[model samples]
Structure formats: C-alpha cells, structure tokens
Target chain A: MQVTLKILRFDPEKDKKAHFKSYEIEADPLDRILDALNTVKWYKDGTLTFRRSCAHGVCGSDAMRINGRNRLACKELVGDIGKKITIEPMLGFRILKDLVVDMEPFFEKYRSIKPYLINYEDPPATERFQSAEDREIFDETTKCILCGACSGSCPPFWSNSEFIGPAAIVNAHRFIFDSRDQGSDERIAVLSQSEGVFRCRTVYNCTDACPREIPVTKAIEQIKRVMLYNR
Target chain B: MYRGQSGMWLWVFHRLTGVGILAFLFLHVADTYLVGLGPEYYNELVFLYKLWVFRLAEWLLVGAVLYHAINGIRVVLMDFWESGVERHTQLVFGTLGLFLLLWLPAGIFMLKDVKWFA
Candidate 1:
C-alpha cells in the first residue's frame, strides 16, 4: 500500500521555523510507522531524522504525534491509521530536528519527582522483600519507559510548564504506593505543591496517550486520595 | 497538545459550563432574594426575567445545565471505573447523545412561551 507521510521538519541551526514536509512511500499494510520512516530516510531523503533504538515499542524512543495522537511510532501499524499520515514532533518540547524533540524538560520533570526508591534503613543481608499483593499495587506504573507520551498529550502540561505532569505523578505513585518504601511523606510534600496533582483536570488524555496502556488517570487519582487520607 | 482529542474537549466544555452555571447561580440567588424585600420589588425583578434577552439566556441555561449534568456523569464514570477510561471517547459521544436528546425537548419546551419562537 502507498501512504503519504507529512512530517514536521525543523533545524535550529538552519531553519528559523518548523515546516511540514511530505513523502510518499510504499509499504505493507501491517508495517509499523517506524518502518515507513526508515524507508523515507533511506530511499527518499537521508535528511529525515528520528530516534528509534529498539525499533520496537519497549524502548519508547520513537514516541511522536502521529495523526494528532501521541504514540510509539514503532508500535503503531500503518493500516491502523489512514492513507494519509501526518507525523510531528511531540508537543510541549523544543524540536531538535524532524520528529526529534528535546526531552530535557521532560526528563527534568521526571527527575524532580525523585523516581528512585528511597529506603534509608540498614541493608538486609538477603534482599528487601515485598509480598505479592503489595508489589501488585504499584506494578502498573513501573512499566513507564520515560517516553513522555503521557506528559506530551496533557493540555495542562502544555499550558503550564510547572505542572508536575502525569509522568511525574505516575513515578511518584510507583514509590508512594509501595508498602516497603518510606519516602511517601517526602514525595507527598513534593506533590502537594500547586503545580502537582491538582493541576490535572482528569482529561484522560494521559491515559489515552500512554503507549504502555498504564492506567495513568487512575494512578493520579490514587495519589490524590493518598494525599487526602495519608497526609 | 493545545488541540486535543475528545477527552480534552470534554474537559473544556465541562469547565466552561461549570463557570457559566456558577455565574448564573449568583444572579439567580440575588434575584430570588428580592422576593423577601417586598411584593413590588419582587414583581419588578420577576419582570426582568420575562424580557426577550433574559428569555434567550434562560434557554441557554437549560442547555448548559443539561450538558453539564450529562458530561458530569461521564467525568465521574471515567474517574471511578476502569472501563470508563478505555471507553472515554465513546462515553463523550454518549454524553453528547444524551445531552442532545434531553436538551432538544427541554429547549423547545422552555422557549415555547417566547414570542420570537412562537
């Protein structure tokens, strides 16, 4: 099948503003968007730049706006989208080049949430153990690949850069809900700020944009509930 | 991100209706309180509501209320139910369908007494 890929092109060094460039490529109906992009880079134009490490959905490197929805290009099939596909760099980020966004702000937000587990207790000789039920509580949020799809899809995050964002909240929830983690109070303090969970209007865009299919809205609400009752 | 999907538009509409209803509520309260002052004052206040402009707003308020009530249900379902999140786009359309079904009749009934529509 033939598909028209209209990609948004930008180069800070050369171009003053971003513009759309279209490419017509032939591919199978079941081919992933990453495959089509690769074909465009190789056969059509070598200047077409995008990041894809795994060429699969796991690495989450190829997250971009495909047809107005944030998705992992490697995971989305060409046939699932229509004959015309409009690809653009993820919104709410500086565009480094065509389809490659500067993810520093996103990562900064992720790091601000203190994503790592904080346990100050003396080390156990064996291992820090957790029951199956306890582990199950926050298991879903651990699937985040730092793709920024959820954060990029959020409207509030776009309007207000300070909003802690869904990705940060999801990361916080990962540790907060962990029965073994003792950093709940500190994380709660960070999240209790004006830019935290309160900014989320529960639009469900984050949940929809998540390639991991993680229940992002539910996790955010869980954090809100925890804040209400626990703190 | 500014131009969002169905879920984002639903959130925007919900908020807009909420603010509209709130503004209307304050006006409604002030108008209702006039009844306690005296019959003459209350009757004059009631006369303003019968004006064509206010009548038009009354129709709009009914539409706004119906939309807010239906979409509010959608928001609650999305928050509490796992299935609602997955089917959120469908739920938005469902809310709109319910809104139109109720609003069309309620709007006609409310505006039936208006001279312009009559």
Candidate 2:
C-alpha cells in the first residue's frame, strides 16, 4: 500500500515560505514510520534532512510531530496510524530544518534544574542498594530518554516557552525521590522560583503525547504536592 | 491555538478555566465581603456596581463564571468512568457551544443594571 506523507519543509536559501511537501511511498502494514521516511530520503528526496541515532526507538533522536502529534518515528507503525500522515518538526523549539529542532533550549531547561545526583554524604564503594519500594517512587520517571515530545506537546511551553516543561521535571524527579539524593530541598527551592512548576495548568497534553506513556501528570502532581507542603 | 485537535483544545480550555475560576473566586469573595460594613456599604457597593466600570467588571465576571461553570461540568464528565472514555472532546465543546448560544442574549441583558447578587 502507498501512504501520502505531507512533510513540512523550510528552505532558508531558496523558499522563504514554510510549506508542506508531499511524497508517496509504498510500504507494508508492518513497516515503521522510520522505514517510510528512509525510503523517501533515499529514493524520492535527496535534500530531506532528519535525525536518527538508532533505527529502533531507544535513542529518541527521531522524535517529531507526526500528524500534529508528538511521536518517535521509529516507534509508530504505519498500520496503526493509517495511509496518510503529516510530519513536522517538534513544537516549542527552534526548527533547524525539516524535522530537527534546536534542542539546546530543551537541554538548557534540563540543566537549570541541576539534573544530577546531589548527595551530602559520600558514596559507598559497593553498588547502592535500596528497597524496591523506594526505587518505585521514581521508576516510571527514569524511563524518559530526554525526548522533547512532552515539552513540545505542552501549551504553556508553547506560549511561555521558558517554563521548565515536563521532560526536565520528570528527569528531576528521577533523582529527587531517590533516598540517596539529599538535594531535593535545594531543587524544590530552585523549582519554586518564577516560571517553575507552578506554570503547569494540568492540561495533561504532555501525558497524552508521551511515547513512553510515562505518567507525567502524576509526576508533576507529586512534585506539586511536595512544593505545596514544603513551604 | 492549534486547530483540528478537539481533545487538546478542551484540555487547554480546562487549564485556562481552572486557573481563571480560582483567581475570580479570590477577588469576588473579597469584593462581596466588603459589604459586611452594613447597608450603607452594601448600597455604596451597589452604587459602584451601577457605573460603567463596575458594569464592565460584572460583565467579565459573568463571562468567566459561565465559562468556568460550563467547562467545570465538562471536567466532571471527563472524570467519570464510562461516558468520558469515548466522548470527552465532543461533550466538552458541544456543551460549551450550546451554552454560549443559549445564554448569550440573556447574559448580555442581565449584565446591565440588574443586581447580580441583589
């Protein structure tokens, strides 16, 4: 079967207007969206530029807006989405080309929360062992691959753009809940500043668009409860 | 502002109305409670209500209330088990649009000179 791909194109040198360009490709129902994109890039359009680290869904480099919804191209199969699909760069970021968004701002927000383990005590030489219940607190959050899908799917991030979005918040939670980490007080203090967790209105759009199906809203609500009780 | 997405837009409106109603409630209670001074204070507040500025405030208040109430019901429905799982988006905008159409004229006239709480 053939599917029509309406990919958003922007050419700084030639075309000033950003427009949708269409390409038809033949593929079976089981084929992943990445396979279709590769077919178009190799045979149909030489100028098409996109990013992919692993052909599988692990690396998360192929995250983009597919049919106006955030997704990893490698993870979506054409059979599930149907015969026609529209592709665009991820939202809430600077579009560098066809499907690559400037993720520097995304990473900057990640770093603003200080996304590393901060413990007042020294590490034990042995592997850190904790009860399964303690690790369960942040187990879902740690599955995030720094994908911009959650941030891109958020509307506050769309208008305000400066609010540290769910991706970073989830990353922060992964460490914040860890028993070994003693920096939650500092991190919560920092997050309580302007344009922080309070900006989220609980739209749950980020929860909807996340490829990993991470309970982003739950994480946000958990952090919000922490922030509320701390002060 | 992205078009053609029903569920997402309802989510956006839910977010806006949720915040809007909270802020309105804070301001409204403060204003109403001011009348506790007595009839003169209540009458004076009503007199303030008679003017164009307070009238404008009342109008926006009416709008915010209507939007919040209508959208809040939508939220309640979405929270329910059966009906929300399928018709979440359709129920939200369909009800909101009907609410606007049914109440627009009455709301506009009721906003003027008419004592909202009085």
Candidate 3:
C-alpha cells in the first residue's frame, strides 16, 4: 500500500525552524514504521534522518511520536496506524533533526535519580539472596528500557523541565523497592523534594505513551506513597 | 495539545473544572456578603439567581463540582494506595460514571423550574 509519512524535519545548521515534509512510499501493510522510514531515507530522500539501532523494540532508540502518540518506530506497524502517519520528534525534548531528539536532558534526569543499585555493604562472596516474593515487588519497573517515551509524554515534565519525570521515577522505583537494595533513604530524600514525585499530577500520559507497557504513572504513584511516608 | 488520548482529556477537564469552581467561589462569597448589607439587598440578589441563565449555570456548576470532587478523590486514592495505580483507568471511568449518575438526576430536578430550553 502507498503510505505518506509526514515527517517533522529540522536542520539546525541550515533551516531556521522545524517543518513537516511528507514522503510517499510504497510499503507492505505489515511493515513496521521504522521500515517505512528506512525506505524514505534510502530510496526517497537521503536527508531523512531517524535513530534505529536494533530495528526492533528492545533498543528503544527509535522512540518518537507517531500519529500523535509516543511509540517505538520498530514496534508500531503501518497497518495499525492507517495509511497516512504523522511522525515527529518526542515531545518535551529539543529536536536535533528529523525524528531525532536531544536525549541528554532525559539522561541527565535519569542520572539524577541514581538509577544504579546502591549497596555499601562488603560484596558478598555469592550474589545477595532475595526471596521470590521480594523480587516480585519490583518486577514491573525493571521492564523499562529508558526510552524517554514516558518522560516525554508527561505533561508535568513538559511544563517544568526540572520535574523529575516518570521514567526517572520508574527507574527509582526499580531500586527503591528492591529488597536487597539499601539506598531507599537517600533516594527518598531526592524524590521528596518539590521537583520530585510530588510534582506528578497523575495525568497518566506517561503510562499511555510507554512502549513497553510499563505502568509509568503507577510507578510514580508508588514513589509518591513512599515519599509521603518518608517525608 | 492534541485531544486524542484519555489522559490528556482528563487533565483538561480537571483543570477546566478547577478554574471554573474557583471563579464560582469568588462570585458566591461576594453574593453571600450582600446579607450584611440588609435583607432587602440580600433578597434582591437571591431573586436574581432565579433567572433562567443563573439557574442553568447552577446545574453546570453542580456538574463541574461533582466531576472535580470525584476526580480529586481518585487522584488522592491513586497517590496513597498502592493498588490504585494498577486500576487507574478503571478509576477514571468509575469516577465519571459516579459523577453522571449523581449529576443527571440532580440536574433533572433542578431544571424543573427554569424551563429555559423547554
């Protein structure tokens, strides 16, 4: 079928502002949005740019707004979104080029949350043993791929860039809820601040936009409960 | 922003209702202060509320209050209860249902005297 992918294009070195450019390409109905984009870059316009590492959903590099929703380009099939699809860079981020956004701000927030597990005790000869029930406590948050989809979809994050986003809260939940981890107090101090989990208004956009189907808002809420008690 | 998703619409409604309620509160307080001016002035203000536009606005205000209050409870539940997170969408629709269930009947009874549209 013939699909017209209307792409938001920006060339900081050349163009003064971003604008939409449509590329009509023949694609199989079942092809992923990434495939259609590849066709655009290869056979249509060489300047058409987007990020794709694995060409699959796992990498999370090709996350962008497709048809007014945040999704992974590799995961969303053309058949699902109909013939004409509007493609743009993710919201709440600076666009570097076509379908490419500057993810530095997102990563900075992730780093601020201390996503890595923190344990100061001497290293155990064997891995720390955690009960099956304890491991299950944080299983949902571990599914996050740090794609920035959840963070970008958040309205609070959009309004105040300083607001620690849903993705950061999700990542924080991963470590905060872990039974074997010991950084809960430190993490709680960071999250309890005005710019932290309290800023989330439960808008649920983060949950809706997550490609991995992670309950981003739920994770944020859980963090809020923890912060409320710890405060 | 595009009005395509349930989350965005809920946020929009919540903000709209909150602002509307705030505006109504100021007007309500201002009118209540008319009681100090004397019964004559207060009765005159109350009589003005019997107008069709004011009556119709009262029904709409009731709906706004119902939605905002119910949705506020949902937000509070989601924040405090761990299980509330898992059932967020259900709670949103549930609150809307409760709002309509209350507002529809109350509106019918309240609109009897106004008969503006009728």
lDDT of 3 at A123: 85
User: What's the candidate order when arranged by decreasing lDDT?
Assistant: 3, 1, 2
Q: Total backbone clashes of model 3?
A: 0
Give stretches of model 1 more than 4 Å off. B1-6, B18-54, B69-105
lDDT of 1 by residue, B21-51 (tens): 9999999899889989998998998897787
Residue A199 in model 1: lDDT: 86
DockQ of 1: 0.34
Q: In the order shown, what is each candidate's alpha-carbon RMSD?
A: 4.1, 7.7, 2.4
The per-model lDDT (C-alpha) reads 0.87, 0.78, 0.87
lDDT of 2: 0.78
True contacts kept of each: 0.38, 0.06, 0.62
For candidate 1, the TM-score is 0.84
TM-score leader: 3
Off by over 4 Å in 3: A14-16, B2-4, B29-48, B115-118
